[model samples]
Target: MTTSEDTLESHEVGLAAPPGEPLQTLTAAEADGLELVHQWFPAPLTVRDGSFALPPEPAWRAVVHAARRHLEAMVGAVGRLECPELGPLTQCGSAWLIRPDVAVTNRHTILSLLDDVQRGARTLRVNLSAEADGSAVLHCPVTRVLYIDPIHDLAFLRVKQRGAPQVGLVVVDSIVTANPVAVIGFPSHAEGGYAEPEYQQIFGDGWFDREGRGFKRISLGRLVSTSDTLLEHDCTTLGGSSGGVIVDLVRGSVIGLNFGESRDRRVNLGVPGWVVQQRLAQLEGSI
Candidate 1:
């Protein structure tokens, strides 16, 4: 147990764990949980070479099918934003790809794209692909300027792509207070990529509290606190991962999109779905 004084000192330095230790280490169970969750998705399923092909049991198969449908709802709808003036953008730092959906990252992750486009880039594209590795894809060109919210640092793009999901754009409504959430996306230049997403559940209710601004980005205690803007949960995300979706496990839907990680390395802030939805709605009338 740590004292209030220790907590204050740690916060002063923006560290979550004590010296010489890291925050959010995965236990054996947590690691296994992530793999199990991914197995529930079918399109991403593949029998690795030399691995034993154990047939999924009847009950397990049912679970997998259901999970796959829900995940499709979350991953199927992605926003593609780009500016040709900046050159073909690559998934580098804090950027990544998930099958069938090329995510347009948050303002901080790909600010250059936004800046150049606003400055009058003649062409821009947002493509949704079929693999996390960016294999087999559908490209969407940004033909019409949509909505943008500076306060929330979010934007919407009306893409031009053939055979896209009928839905305009979907976002997560809310996150479970003390349940699990998963971040799905590709990483920066990772060759041996995991076929499916990683899932991590919050063990307790620990939150990021900064004045009345109330950024929720920690999982501790039993009272799990949350914010309409920021989100806090126990999951792993890294470079090339900025625009990925944060799915609320209980709801089986995306609640947020990864934007930035806190200095503590324990929390990541996401653009809430409500913000994304509001921007898109405004664009509908204009379009």
Candidate 2:
């Protein structure tokens, strides 16, 4: 809730949440709750970039706890193949789900699994864990798949899992010049994944135009260079967070999908929400 314009790295060092809480799983009931909460706000929350600046000790611990709790309900939606059985594999370099009810992730994540399958990997498995404790659950079947951009690497999957809580879909919205934004996802390095969020204020906010909406990456710092981008405090994202929601906190809506980060490891790039809308619409049509 703090607002600042500083880019500081907030490290998440802690234990993960357990996966036993039925309430943590995405469900219709939870979706209703989110809708109710959205109605209370006039606009979605806009995210900006800045360090969370934990006050040291337990407070930082609380932050880490919150992040782990969030991840507990998230399930990894992986690709499957039948030629050979390689058992279940994790998107070791990807993030968890944005909404638990429906497991969504960067299309490339699933694609990567497919790549492995073509290379003689067997059985694509979706990773699901309990929300209360980080208990590992086996193969959560994927019932549906929705891709926003065949080329852009965005996809949403309808998975079948027991005890998932009701979840509301985060819809993308129209863009405005210099709008505020926030991202909620698990990021990580090649070494491993982190449960914390990677928050970056679009120093300047922009969106994907209709023609250019396919698969594109927008640089957060570049926006700041072009226009005004509002940022928030203490948000840092790591690996294993692909396909998480980049929300308009002020507007209470989603603005983009977390795809990748900067090479220097500073700015975070997000795919605009409008593009997500287009892809979702395509999904609905195909369905």
Worst ten-residue run, lDDT, model 2?
213-222
TM-score of 2: 0.48
TM-score of model number 1: 0.55
**C-alpha lDDT (0 to 100) for residue 81 of candidate 1:** 36
Q: Tens-digit lDDT track for model 2 on 6-112?
A: 11211111212123223212257844653443233111111112112222335333433344323222122221111124322233223233445355566555554
lDDT of 1 by residue, 87-178 (tens): 43433222222222223345543344555556664555653442322345555665544544455544444555568443433455654556
RMSD of each: 12.6, 16.7
- For model 1, the local distance difference test gives 0.40
Counted clashes in each candidate structure: 13, 59
- Give the Cα error of residue 134 in candidate 1, in Å: 6.6
Q: Rate residue 26 of model 1 by lDDT.
A: 50
The TM-score leader among the candidates is 1
